[model samples]
Target: MMSPIASLTLSISDNATPYYLQLREQILAAIREKRVSPEDKLPSSRSLANMLGVSRSVVTQTYDQLVAEGVLVSKPKRGIFIANTSLITMPLESLPEAKSAEPEKTVGYFDSSADHSVFPHKAWAASMRRAWLNPDPKILMGNYRLGFPQLKEQLAKFLYSLRGLECGAEQIIITAGNRDALQLLQHMLKKHVNQWYTENPTYPPINASLTGQLEHLDVQLGGALPPENTSPWAAVITPCRQYPLGISYSSQCREKWLQTLSEKQGFVIEDDYDNEFIFHGRPVTTLFQAAKHRVSAEERVFYVGSFSKTLFRGLRLSYVVVPKAFVKPVLESQKQLGQSASLPMQPALSDFMASGAFYRHLNKMRRHYRMKRDYLESLLNAHLSQWFEWEKPTAGMHILLRLKTPYADDPEISGFLKSYAMTQGLQLSLLEDHYVDPMLATKGIVLGFSNTSENDMECWVNVISQCLGCYFDG
Candidate 1:
C-alpha cells in the first residue's frame, strides 16, 4: 500500500502566522476531516519537508508538537502515524468567529479594583529582579508550605504598625486571595463549628465560599454579636470598612464581638481588605487586635488581608493570621491540599515590603483614590442629588446611593438601572444582590470610584441620571 503521506495535501502561506504553525494547523485539519486514519504511516521529516518546499526543521517542529498533543504517535524505527485519539471533534465550520485583537471599549466600569495607571511599576520591577537574582534557598526549594517566612515577618510588622495587632510570622498562612483564605478557614473550622454568620449586605463572595448552615447578621441593626450561645460558630466580619456600606465597626461593637466569641468558643474571620485605603483619619481598631488582648487561649479572630485592593487584583496574594494554636494544623492542611498562592511572587513581595516600596505605593494610592472619591461625590451631588441620597464615605473605595423615592418594587427598579447602564458601557451593581434575603435589602446602588477616572466618573454619573430619568418618565 502507498504511504498516507503521498495521498495527503499540505500547504503554507507567507502570512502573519509562523510557517510551522500553519503546517501544524493543516495537518490537524486533515486529521479532523478524516483524510488520515489511525496507524497510517507518514514520510519522515526530511521527505515531508522536500515535498512541502519547507525546511526540515519546520516539519520536525510541527511533528514534535503534534506528538506532544497526542494527535500523532511515533513508533521507533517505524514512522509517524495518526494516533487513535480524536482532536476536538467539533467541526471547524461550526466554530464561532474569532474575536478582534483590540479590547472592547467601555465608557466606564465602576469596579472596586486598584487603579493600574497609578501602580509603582518601576519599584515593583526592581523588587522582582532582586528576588530572582538573589533568591533564598528555601524559596527555590519550596520548603515553606505555610508561606515565605520573609513575607510573613514583614506582614507581621505591617499589622503592628498599621493596626496595632501583634502576631508571629509562624501564625500567618499565605493564600491566593480573600476567597482562598476563607475556603481554608472554612475547611479548618468546619469540623468544630456547625453554623456560620456574615453581615447582611456583605461581600457576595464571602457568602458563596463559607460552608455549613449560614446566616446573616443585620448591619442595619448595629451588626451586633449573636446572643451568648454554647454552640461553636464562625462569623466573617469586615470591620475595617464593611463592604457596600463602607462603615467601620465601632470600638464598642468590636469589644462586644470579641467578648462574645471568647465566651461562646466561636471564631470571627476579620476580613481587613482595603484597610490601607482609609481616606480620612487613621484606620479603625481591628477585631483581631481586640481579640488578642481579651482572649488568652486560641485567639478567636482570623485576620485576613489582601494586596489585591492596595496593589492590583491580578497579583492574587493574600494572607490570614491565625491563632497560635492553628499554626501546626493549618500548615498540615496546606501540605495535604497544596499551597494555592503562587510561590514565585512571595519572595518578590517580601522584597517589595522590605525596600519600602509597598508602603510608598500605599501612600500614593491613598491620595489618588481619595481624590477620585471626592470627584465622584461631587458629580453625583451636582447631577443626581435630587433623586439620590448618600453619606460620603470616609474610607474604602465605593459609595452607596440610596434612592430618595421609595419604590414598592425596589429590586425591579435596581434591575432596570443595572441593565440600562450596561447598554451605555457603564457597569452598575445592585445593592439588593448583596443581601442574603433580597426582600430585606435596601433600595440603593453601589458605585466604585477607585478604578474610574474623573472624566469617566462624570460621564457615568450623567448616564445614571439619564437612566433614572427614563425609568421614572416612562
Candidate 2:
C-alpha cells in the first residue's frame, strides 16, 4: 500500500567544472557517508548517467575508478554495491599543522548586497567581443599598468571640457574601481596625511579606510570646515551627491573647503561618483572645477570617478586626475606596487567612448532611472507618508528613507522589512548600518529603484506600506 521510494542522482551544470571529477566525488561521498550501504543495489551506468544528467562515459569512468580503488564492487550479472571499507570523518586536531606560525586575522564590516540580475549582459558581451577582435596587439598584450594612453587622453579632454578643469593625460591614473582608488590613494598618502574630513553620514568604505592614520572630521549640513591654522592634513569628500543623505555641498561650502585646504597646505580628494546620473537640473559645479579656477597647481587636489556605476560593475575601471607634478610619483608607485589595469578593458572602454556608444547608453539609462525615481518618490509619498521622509536624491542608484520614529532598531526593522519584502518578491536595502561612526547611522533604509521592474516597484511599495502599517498598528 506504501508508495515506492523514488531514486535520485546528483546532477550539475557545465559551469566551468569537470564532469568526471564531479561524478567521482558524488559517488565517493555517498559510499563514505553510508548513504549507500554494502550490498545495496545500484542503478546501471546508463540509468545512473541519465538520472545524474551527465554522459554515460563520465559515470563509467567514475565507477571504474571507484572499482579500482576497491570502494565499489561490480558483479558479473548484478549491479554495483558499496565496498566494506571503514567510513570516517577527520577532526581538526588530527590534521597536519601548518608549517609557518602565522597569526589568525578576521576583518568584518557592512557588505553591500549588490543586485547583479540587473546587469546589461548583452551590451557587455558585445563590448567584450569587439575588444577581443581589436587588431591592436599592444592593447591586447602590452603592459597596460599605466592604463591605455588613449583612454587617459580622452578622459583628460573630457574632464577639461566637462568639469572645467585643467587636467591633462599625464595627470590621469586609471584604477580598477572606486574602492581600489581610495584604498591605494590612502596608502600613498597615509604617512604624509595625518587627518581626514568628510560628512558625518559619509560613505562607510571611505570612513572605514580613514580609520588608522587620520582623524575624521564629521560635518553635518551647513557645517564649517576646520580652520587652516589647525593643520588638518587632508579631506576626502563627496561634494556633488553625498551618500545616504544625498545632500550636495553649497558653493559657500566649496569655497570654505578650498580656503581651508589652501591655508592648511593640505589636499582634497573629491569623489564625483554619480554626478552624471543626476535626476534634477544641471549638477552644481564640482569642487574640482571650483578648486581648478581658484587654487594653484601645487595645492594637491585630486578628482576621482568610476565607470563601474555608469557602464556596469564588471568593467572595474575608475580614473584619478592628479596634478602634473604628482603624476610621475604616482605612476612610479603604481609600477613598483604592480598596480595595473586590464589591457583590453581600457581599449574597449576607449572604443565605446570614442564611438559615442557609452554616452548613448548613459543617456538611455539616465532617462530610465529618472522615470523609476519619480515613480518611487510618488509611491513613498503616497503610502508611507507618515512613517518616513526622504530628500529627493539628485543622483545615484539608491534613495535614503529616514524613518519618522525608531519603530525598531536596525536588526529588528531590517528583519521585519526583509521578511515582508521577500514574501512579496520585493527587495529593499537597509542603508543605515553603512555608517562606521555609529551615532551617525540613520533610522532609515536605502531603496535601489534602478534594478527593479515597474511592476515590482508598485508591488513592493504596497508591501512596504502594509509592513509599516503593521508595525505601527501594533
What digit string (tens of lDDT, one per residue) describes model 1 on residues 181-288?
A: 888888887677878888888889888877767877888535545545568778888877888787777767766777677675788888888878877787787777
Alpha-carbon RMSD of each model: 10.9, 13.8
lDDT score at residue 326, model 2, on the 0-100 scale? 71
Q: Which residue runs does candidate 2 get wrong by more than 4 Å? A: 1-135, 140-142, 209-214, 223-232, 405-428
Q: Score candidate 2 by lDDT.
A: 0.65
Tell me the lDDT of candidate 1: 0.78
Per-candidate TM vs. native?
0.78, 0.69
Give the clashing residue pairs of candidate 2, or none: none
Each candidate: what lDDT?
A: 0.78, 0.65
TM match of model 1 to true structure: 0.78
